[model samples]
Target: PGLEVSMTMLAVDALLDEVAENRAHIGLAYNPPPHARIAYRASSAQPVVLLLRKDHPLAKRGGPASLNDLQAYPLALMPSTFGIGHVVSMAQVAANVSIRPTLVTNSLSALKRFVTAENFMTLVGEFAAYRELGSEELTTVAVAHPLFESAQARVLVKADRPLAAGPLELLKWIEERMPMFAPVKRPARRKPIR
Candidate 1:
C-alpha cells in the first residue's frame, strides 16, 4: 500500500455512527467527532478558500463582502449532512437568507466543473482546491465570515484491534511527512492535542 490507500465517502453522520459502532478498518474520516478517531492533519500553511472563475460577479465584487454578500450567488455545496455541513449552514444564517445551492455534490471535481461552466461558487477546504487554485483553473475568494474553519481527516483501525503493521506504517509516514506538503500559507495553525 505504498501509494494506494483505502478510502470511503459517507455522510458525516454515517461516518461517525459507523466509527462509533467500532466495526471496520476505518482509517481517516474528515469532519469527525462521533464519526471518527485517530485524527491526522498535516498541513501547516496558508489555505485559500475558493470560488469560481474571477468573472463571476461575487468574485468580482468591488469591496469585501460579508456572508450576506455571498447570498446572491448560487452555490455548489455538499449536502448539509456531509462533513462541515455547518459551512453552508452558517453561511445561510449569517447572510440571513434562505439560500440554496445551484447544485450539491460530493465530487469536488464536479463542484469545480460546475463553477467553470456556470460561474457558480462554493466554499471548500483549501487543500481540496489546491491544484486548481494554484494552476489558475479555479480562483480563490475571500469569505468575510470568520465562520470559516478547517477540518482534520482521521485514520482509525478496526474495532478492538490496533492498526496492522502496514497501515500503521503508512499512518506514521503521513504524520511525519505531511506537514511539508502543505500549501504555502496555512489558514490556521495545527495545534497538538493537549
Candidate 2:
C-alpha cells in the first residue's frame, strides 16, 4: 500500500508513444491506432455522443441524433489533437458528412461550459460527461452513425515489458475497476424460481 504513483495526462498520440517507449507504466487511450510496440490490457466500447444542455431542441426530441441534425446547431468541438476529435473527423470523412464547428478547443471544461451556457452542442465520448449526465443540466444523445459505433477506450502498456510489483498491482486494480468507470448495461434480473 506504500506505492508511489505518478500520473500524467497526455493526448492520444503522446500517450501511445510514452507507453511504447516504456516511459510510462500505463496509459488510457481512446480509439488508439494500432502500434506494434503496444499491448492492450483491456478495452471497452466508447461511442461518440452528442453533448448538449437538457433543454436543447435535440434533447427534447428524446431520441438518437444524426449528423444532419447537428447542422442546425452551433457546434463546439475539441481540436483533432485529442482522440475524440480525431475519431469524429475520421467518422465524418468515412460517412461523407462534413460539419464545421463554431468553436474548437482542447479544454473539456470549456466544452462543458459552452454547452451549458449557450444552446451550443459538442461531440464527445459519453464517459466525458458522466458526472454531468447524473445532474439535470447536461445530457447526451447517441449519435446514429455506423463509424462512431465501434470506437474503443483502451488500457495499454508496452509489449513484452514485465511490469514491476507496484505497477502490476495497479494495473490489476484498474482492470477490476474499469466497469465502474465505463457504463455497461446489465440485463434485468428475473424473479427466482417460484
Candidate 3:
C-alpha cells in the first residue's frame, strides 16, 4: 500500500476552508459551519464537558455539573476563537451564567496541565481529553445545558470532488473508527480499596 498522508492542525474556520478550497483532501473538525462546497461524510456527537482532576470536589458530585457551579472554581479556558470556546461563550450567554476564567490560552496541553497541576477546571469537547480520561488522571462532568448537546465531531470533504485512492482509503478508515471517538457516559467514580 503506497499511501502518504499529511496532517495539519488548524483552527475550525481554517480547517473547513482547507477542505472546501481543495487544499486538503479531508478535514476533521468540531461543529464546523455549513459551507456550499463542503460535505459532511460522517459525524459524532462530542458534547462540551468540564475537565478536571479526578479527586476534585466537583468530581465527587458523581453527576452532571451546572454552568453556575463553575463560578466557585479557578477556571482556565481556551479563547473564544476555538470551537469549544465559542460554544461555551454562547452557552454562557444563553444560560445567563457568568464565568471569569483565571487563565485563557489556545493550547489544549496548557489547559490539561493547568487542571492537572492546580485546582483549575477547563471546559472542552469530551474527546479533547480522551487520553487523560483513559488514564484516569482526569474525569469529565457533563454540562447540564441544551447548547452543549449538539456539538459534533465531523469528517468533511469537498462537496463535489471525488477523492483519489489514498485519501478515499484514509477516509474509509477514519469512518470505520469514528465511533471509538464518540463521547461515552463516564461511570461514577469508584473508591480505591486498600
Candidate 4:
C-alpha cells in the first residue's frame, strides 16, 4: 500500500463516534465499547502488572503483589478517563481499597518519569511495558487479582464500510501481530535408539 499512515489519539468515546460516522477507517482502543456499527478485527485479553523502579521497595519482594500491597506506595496512575484506568478502577473497587496517586496523567512518559524520580508505582498492560521491563529500568509485580486479570485490547473497524487497501493491510498486520500471552512451545525430543 502506498498510502501514508496518519495516527491520532482520541478518547474512547470520541474514537468510537468517529468510527461510527466514517470519519476514520479504523480505531485501536484498549477497551472497545460494545456497539453494532463496529466490527472487531482482533482483540486480546492481557494481564495487568504493577510497574515500579527496580530499587523500589516492592521490587525486592520477588513475588506477585495484590492490590492491597500497591496501596502502601504513592501511585502515578492514569486517570479514569482512559480505558486502562477503567480496569484499574474496577480492581480497586473489588479489592475494597483506594489507590491514591501522587500524580495522575494519561501520558506514558510522565508515568515513567514519576516512577523514576520517586518511589511511585503504576499499573500497565504487560505487553505495553514489555520493552521497558526487559531493559531493567522497571520491574513488574503481578496484580494477581481477579477483577484485573481480564482487561482487553481491541482493534475496531467500521461495520458498514469495506476496508480499503491501506486499512485492510493495517487490520491484517494488527491481527497477525497480536502478542501471544502464553508460554512458547518447545519441540519434543526424538528417540535416540529404535
Highest lDDT: which candidate? 2
Per-candidate TM-scores read 0.70, 0.88, 0.84, 0.83
Cα deviation of 174, candidate 4, in Å = 1.9
Q: Which ten residues in a row have the lowest lDDT in candidate 2?
A: 176-185
lDDT of 1 by residue, 1-194 (tens): 45556667777666656555664344444444442343333433332255678787766764555566556777788778765465557556776767567788878788888888876887666667767777766677765555554444445444455666776677677656665433456489788999
- Candidate 1 at residue 72, lDDT? 74
Please report the TM-score between candidate 4 and the true structure: 0.83
How does each model score on lDDT? 0.61, 0.86, 0.86, 0.78
| Pairs of residues clashing in candidate 2 | none
Q: Is candidate 3 or candidate 4 better by lDDT?
A: 3
lDDT of 4 at 13: 72
Q: Mind giving the per-residue lDDT tens digits that candidate 4 earns over 8-111? A: 98767778888989999888887655778988777778777888999988888778887778778898877776676777777677767787777888787788
Error of 3 at 188 (Å): 30
Candidate 2, 36-97: lDDT as tens digits: 99999888888889999989999999989888887789999887877887777887788788
Error of 1 at 113 (Å): 0.6
Whole-structure CA lDDT of model 3: 0.86
Instruction: Locate the minimum summed-lDDT window of 10 residues in model 4.
Output: 176-185
Q: lDDT (0-100) at residue 134 of candidate 2? A: 88
